[model samples]
Target: MTSPGMSITQLLPDGKLIVLCGRADDASAWQDLLGPARCLAIALDDAPHEARPRTLRGASDHLAWQHHAIGGLDGSGWLAEPADAFDPDHTATLVLPDPLDPPDAGNRRRFGFRRPAWRLFEDKTMVDTLWDAAGVPRAPSIVGDGTADLSVLGAIVDQGTGVVCSCQPRGAGPSAGGDGIWWWREGPPPTTIPTAGPGTWRVRLMPLLEGVPVRLHGLALTTRIIPFPPMELVTLPRPGQGTFLCAGAVPLLDDAADLVTHTERIGVGLRERLGYRGGFSVDGILTPSGFQPTDFNARLTSAMEAAPSDRRVLLHAVNLLAREGNEPDTGAVEQLAEDLFTIGTSCTIFGAATHADDRASRTTSVRWDGDRLVPAPSGAADGRLLITPSPRGWLLTATLATARLPGGGRVGPRAPEIFRVSDEVLGTNFGHLVPPFDTRPSACLPKVALNPEPATR
Candidate 1:
């Protein structure tokens, strides 16, 4: 068991740490969060080739890079050059897996990675069952094989808008962020689904809940669960195109006490049922009928990744300790959650596909002018917009000056304008994207008790 006073460095294994990620910024960010320590950070992306410790570019397969890293410093292949730095007998290497990938089995040197069994919950088709067991209210959904008639299943759950079909990663690897999902209205069904691999895959059909998409993050400790504030998932749908873009996340304005309660219940259910420990998030749409969950992420989600560096680092340490069967100080964990709530600031980063291969990085001072983002002097700016390249495309990180935001309202509506500004000034290509609709809280739904008993399905 770790003491409450132990720092994040103390909780980690005593050895040379290796941080592996898909983005250069991610590698640098993780290195910063881990504090001043003896760490070797490696990024597997094409951009920012000059970063410290260097990056292994042209490696399209992030999982394969992780697998190579797990093989230790003595092995050959892509890691051989990087492996020449340290002697295997004298220097013990501890690896930090990519946030999206779980650590391989029998690797005792890996830290802060999700268990392989818990990774199963990330499949879109399997989350509804967990929601039911947790007593979290969700829209109707049905899972079927790839060849199953989606129209029939879509009719069963289709509201007025349409049904959402999310592909199941059965034999293939897990779906990338926001991939493998499509919105269908009336058509012959999707001919191609975005999955990690080819061949047949399962699908989960559910009603496309209309409202503001929000995600509630929670940390499950040994004794209890700590829920964080809700963030608006800035999802832009390309209507008739059957696809949606996950632009970024910002703090939600609506009161979400009931949603927080549901998050707590879900934490209990996950702990009791699956012995799940660490951070998890529930993605849902706040509709006219209340918050209806749509997806569950068992690993460290992007929202959590966007939190303040101090909070993120602490939570990561606590999560790693809890997952290793060690009890973290409950009171300290509660205090950390309360501190995050009191801060009430969110990290907003907009994503878009780009054709540029510059592999360069740029930061611009900007402020929100009405509904658009315009350049401003650094001292007078409301936020700083950073553009960086990733394996998929480019990422625009908007570090907002919270006090300067007018009304402190939701940032979802401004995503399209951000892309427009980027394309115009930065010479990047991000085509038209539709903004999300405002949320409508349900009047018929009753308030959820903060401390309700666990309910069975």
Candidate 2:
């Protein structure tokens, strides 16, 4: 859905179309309450955010160090600086990756803080408490400080399927995926808690549910939650050891009434109470009993990559706001979201390879900052998703529909024809392919163009 006052258009440069957001969402009510649009503009800057490590919750002035793992978005919508570091007039958006904890009354005064992100989303534990308070159905689990409680886990896993443990820290580190989530293979649970080893580690244990996983998502100030279909997790090992592939995630979320309404209420309630805004997610498992929420994320989620609405929702949120003296069309933004909902089913397939060497560049950078694909200084700042298609191989990063992924499965499926191939062997056919020549241009050979034509020799 678009902002009441904002619209998006495309322009072509060099024969490629570029998407641009024009006009702006009217923010008279927000302005009347908060004063100035700059207060909301703070979310767009990268400097202060990059200078420190930022995650969705439980941040404090005394404890803003970057953590052990980075999140899916590479760290957009985050900040490492203190609440007082940037004035409210300098805030990027209603969302902050490191907004002051909602309970921090002591620090609220530093910014005169009319509209700081009220942090209801401090952590999974905090959310669990809130869900209980709201009488929402949640999966049963235990949290430990990364000390494996084999007895507890074994008992829990034995009751149902198995247990999946998510590391309680945010931010990606070398070879750490989804902050290093681990699943207990089919076996007897361990007898004792494992050592914390080296870093700050904690784990949230959840019993594997029998139902499929689906995502309930929303963005901007609009509370219309869209339930998109669940994505199946696919994995192909790399040379080192990790589920790396032409990663596709069309994580499930579709407009299931029971889940959608609750998600909206929760999302809107959080925004209204905490003044927290921007992209937020609540993932649930679709069981025969009903939808049961198992996870909550207060920032742009990994599933956002699989959601088409994400780009527009983010763009609408960042659209121009009412200046100091202007009057806000109070209901315009709200009405637009309610009436103009238009995001189709989304499926995201990231990490397309344009060359065998492409994997090398991809492994080093955040998923968004691909070497040969992205526009210089990458980010969708101008309302465009990046795609640098080359003759060799093209990198595709998009919020498309479920139909797009899997290259559209077979029509008359007799056990379903496999479209994409994988290998039990890692690094079977991936590596650097450098030309034998010292390819750098110099005085000896300032310019060199190997013939486009194949040589007989």
Candidate 3:
């Protein structure tokens, strides 16, 4: 039975169109999220907000799911009916809320793709300014003006300390280099830190052992450690508490309750600070000290859909779409969430492909192939979860589960996972097509860190 106080409006599918934005959340994830219920999945042709349908997958194919476009609408409540409204060729009209609408703006700011807080939060130099104010734990950080000596970076880490480097524009878009690097005293000597075309990049500092590689991801106040290199120190905040880790690497969050609480706090705090209208994620490190944030993602992140079943992360999706500013009742939400978690009905996020195309970028599938996350090849016919990049980055709108990782890691925090597929390989063997890519971009995303590199998921 649905939880009491759970309004029908909360579960309303009426006029609710679930849209797939990019190669993320292909088909399978869509089916898993929307269930066998009838739905349509449409692909948009443009980037950012210039959304136009390049292809359409119908619901009958088991490949198709419900999708629509919320193009060019501000925060007001004024709705813009497409010029081709009722076009004979089209089956439905495009609907959007006004940007000026209070609830609409609030909702948009809360869940929209552009999250500004992540920028201010992840700046290592900003440590003294914002960390304590946000209720985040404090740690030793080495800051740079982007022009300091790399060896000094090593000194800052001293003996047993980790390093965090923030690289800024060194040259042009693809040519710009780094701002500076951060590390702890225990890490190895500073190696070449790749610079990206001046966008925004942040790194987490931790003790690095000999031959350990550092290929981290995330921007500004949120960064995650790449698990390819084993880590010894990890910290996690108590569940629902205000403190959190900012990095993306999950290996550090070994405790479930701690992860849930800190994650909730980080999620709620970020939404409030950034005026972001979409998804944002904060990565963390579980050190002996506690869960400390390493970095932040202002847009839809890989973690958005990874929560275990009983968590019903779909509620997050629903809440993201609801009127903003009005915080949901924490007590009531906790009660309902507990019920969902107890039933083992959590949500997993996935990505989709255009035409079973192997060129799909980003992590799309999560199944255990002897304990690692090996992404299932994506394509329209494959029925994998679908996701798309908007002006804000990647958006996750679907979900699924694949073979469990070996050992007893538990696929997504627990066993008996949801929507298990037969591992019927789909799409072309594009694994080669997706190069782990130079995350740093300036150094051509730089070759995978020498020692411990990212293990393919």
Tens digits of per-residue lDDT for model 1, 1-457: 6534365456667767665555556566567655435666666553233321222222223344455444533443354445345424435444454363533422335666677667776788887888788667778988887646777878888877788998865665566567778886665556554433334788889988777787878778777787877677878776646777786566656567777777777788888888888878888787765677888878656665465655655665666777776755677776766665433543566664554436433666788787567877555777776776554455666677655555555566666666766666666666666676443322222343343575321
TM-score winner, 2 or 3? 2
Show how many residue pairs clash in every candidate, following the order shown: 0, 27, 127
- For model 3, the run of ten residues with the poorest summed lDDT: 433-442
Query: Candidate 2 versus the native: TM-score?
Result: 0.48
Which stretches in model 2 have alpha-carbon errors above 4 Å? 1-122, 169-177, 188-194, 197-200, 219-255, 268-278, 302-346, 351-457
Listed in order, each prediction's TM-score against the native is: 0.80, 0.48, 0.43
Cα error of candidate 2 at position 449, Å: 65
Span of 10 residues, lowest total lDDT, candidate 2: 414-423
lDDT of 2 by residue, 263-325 (tens): 555555555455544545565555555666665655444443342333434333332221111
What RMSD does each model have against the real structure? 5.0, 17.7, 14.0
Off by over 4 Å in 1: 1-6, 22-39, 44-74, 80-84, 90-93, 97-108, 186-199, 307-311, 335-347, 356-369, 372-384, 403-408, 437-457
Model 3: per-residue lDDT, tens digit, 213-303? Answer: 1212211122211111111111111112211111112221122433444444544444345433333444433333354554443333333
In candidate 1, how many Å is residue 4 off? 7.3
- Candidate 3 wrong stretches, greater than 4 Å: 1-119, 122-128, 168-192, 195-255, 258-281, 297-301, 304-318, 321-323, 327-332, 335-457
Best by TM-score: 1
Task: Assess candidate 3 and give its TM-score to the true structure.
Answer: 0.43
